[model samples]
Target: MESKEEHYSHDHIMESIRNLSENDAKTFLNLIYALLRDNTLPSEQLVSHVLSVYEKKIPRVVKTRQNK
Candidate 1:
């Protein structure tokens, strides 16, 4: 079980990410990728790990916007 503080921290991080501009979000994601790459984790392993963690979260329909 997650502690209240941990839950709040997670929510805050997600909210912050959601509010980022598209370019900033892309840059943030690149930074995350660079950090993982620097740690010598293989891209395949990262993808597998992320998918497993995401699967454990609540399932929902992810809607993608069509770029005009």
Candidate 2:
């Protein structure tokens, strides 16, 4: 069983990942891929496929400020 500290650390790490910029997240994901490349991890492939599908489905939003 995970202790309170372990759970908190896991949640904190997940939140940090969620808050990362798009490019930063991609870099992080690639690092994870490299780490899991030794064994054929189904999860790695699943996440990559899911992200690719969503990327194709969702259009990117450009944030621009209007001139005052």
Candidate 3:
């Protein structure tokens, strides 16, 4: 059986992908398409890669105060 730790890691990876830049996300999707032609692709890897890209670009800042 799959462990909860595995599940959580998978979920976190997907969340990172959701945070990816639009262009990066689209490019990864296209890569998936090209790579999966007549074959099975590992979605988790693709999603994780997308998220890794996001992690590089997304700042950790939660908020900024300017005119507030």
Candidate 4:
């Protein structure tokens, strides 16, 4: 049995992904494609979920007015 501490949580995985260089990212994506090809992952729904999570994390910009 694996303890929670032994598991790579979503945040840890995301942080690792964020640290990858472009070439590494390409290799990572190729592995994902292979997994998809072998039916190891869900198709478009996974992409949609990732995109939704990414979009929600973007910080909104607010404008401020200055008084003279």
Top lDDT hit: 3
Global fold similarity of model 2 (TM-score): 0.39
The prediction achieving the highest TM-score against the true structure is 4
The C-alpha stretches of model 1 lying farther than 4 A from their native spots are 1-8, 40-68
How should the candidates be ordered by TM-score, best one leading? Answer: 4, 1, 3, 2
Per-residue accuracy of model 1 over 1-68 as CA lDDT, tens digit each: 43322322455445544555677656556755666666566878877555433332211111122121
RMSD in Å for all candidates: 10.6, 12.3, 9.7, 13.9
lDDT of 2 by residue, 1-68 (tens): 32322322444444554555687567656755665565465877767654542342121211111111
Q: Candidate 1 local accuracy as lDDT? A: 0.45
lDDT of 4 by residue, 1-68 (tens): 43323434467556655655577667656755655566644768767544433332211100011111
Cα lDDT for residue 41, candidate 1: 62
lDDT of 3 by residue, 1-68 (tens): 43323323455555656556687667766765665563454888766654544343222211111112
Residue 40 alpha-carbon offset, candidate 2, angstroms: 11
| Positional deviation of residue 29's Cα in model 2 after best superposition, in angstroms | 0.8
C-alpha root-mean-square deviation, candidate 3: 9.7
What is the lDDT, from 0 to 100, of the residue 54 in candidate 1?
30
Once model 4 is optimally superposed onto the true structure by TM-score, how far is the C-alpha of residue 7 displaced, in angstroms?
1.5
Task: Provide the lDDT at 31 for model 3.
Answer: 62
* TM-score attained by model 4: 0.43
Q: Model 3 TM-score?
A: 0.41
